[model samples]
Target: MVTRRRLPRAFFERPTLQVARQVLGQRLVRLEPEGGRLAGLIVEAEAYVGSEDLGCHARAGRTARNASMWGPPGHAYVYFTYGMHWMLNLVTEREGFPAAVLVRALLPTEGVEVMRRRRRGRPERELTDGPAKICQALAIDRELDGHDLCNPDSRLFLEAGPGVPEQAVTTGPRVGLNSVAEPWKSIPWRFQVRPEYIPSLAEEEQTP
Candidate 1:
């Protein structure tokens, strides 16, 4: 039984970009209706600051697609992508900063049997590894938008976990943002779990 430690509200009130980098190795937990729980170790993340970030939705301000980004910190900012998948993001910074941390990849840890079922027949590597995949495996969707991540009753929340060493963590360019250009696109803000732990496409193709 893994005991989850809820992060303080102030933990999310800081700069979204920094929070994104700092959140590596933490655990993300989702409570199920039947009193069961699902969780995974955060393995990858990307940061999106306000309008200055060309890759950020907040660059457009308060539109229907990005309204949740403008809310207070510790809120979920779930969104659809590529016209097919839903991605999960956590709102960061004080109100109006419009920053968020994109949870890109996760290493399935607890309640993996449930995740395997939710993933249907998909390979194990694809289970909870990518942004859209994590949401799908965890059953997160648009309905969870703006949910309070800090609330004990909320379906989603983050937990403090073992620290990943600096040498073990690696940084790289974000995926699927070739059009952003300049430092923004090349910021190397993307973080991921050590290579050995990364799920292979073949492994990902195996169902449970």
Candidate 2:
């Protein structure tokens, strides 16, 4: 059973990489306008640290779109990308620091039917298998940009859940950085649960 205890701001006021890994096995929940909940078990995430990281959005400094990243920790940094998809990111580190963790994948545990419907009747395995897919499944968009995740009344918040052991976690380079520079492109900042820990995608979505 997952605890309803929402993660406090202090939980995110840490190194970006640390927050990314620690978020694994937690619960990402969205409370719909009608009071329904769409939640999942966080299983994959990527870290983007500071303005110096070439692969990070803050590399170019703050802008209107990324203003939320410069806000206090424990706030949502939702952004639209590729002219189509909305991505969900959680800001981390101290205020004014542009650091955040990109939530990459989730295992649907609540509101599976709604997720499947939002995902266009896709199978359970495909409902929230990727970053963009997770947003789509949960109906997250610019509306929640900079939303305070630590607020008890917030529609979007994270909950404490089972902690994933180090042995069950894996690290690798983030996806989709073809044009990014070296070192940053290959940095092992992406974190995910080992294949054996997840049921659906373990065999169907093998990774190198």
Among residues 3 or more apart in sequence or in different chains, the pairs in candidate 1 whose N, CA or C atoms overlap within 3 Å are 123-204, 123-205, 123-206, 125-204, 126-204
All candidates' TM-scores? 0.90, 0.94
What C-alpha lDDT, on a 0 to 100 scale, does residue 66 get in candidate 2? 93
Question: What TM-score does structure 1 among the candidates reach?
Answer: 0.90
Pairs that collide in candidate 2 are: none
What TM-score should be assigned to candidate 2? Answer: 0.94
Residue 62 in candidate 1 has what lDDT?
A: 76
Candidate 1, residue 97: the lDDT equals 82
RMSD of 2: 4.6
lDDT of 2 at 186: 97
Q: Model 1, 157-204: lDDT tens per residue?
A: 998866466776788888788888788888887877687644442243
Error of 1 at 124 (Å): 2.5
Could you tell me how far off, in angstroms, the CA of residue 80 lies in candidate 1 after the best superposition?
A: 1.1
Runs of candidate 1 exceeding 4 Å displacement: 197-208
Displacement of the residue 204 alpha carbon in candidate 1, Å: 23
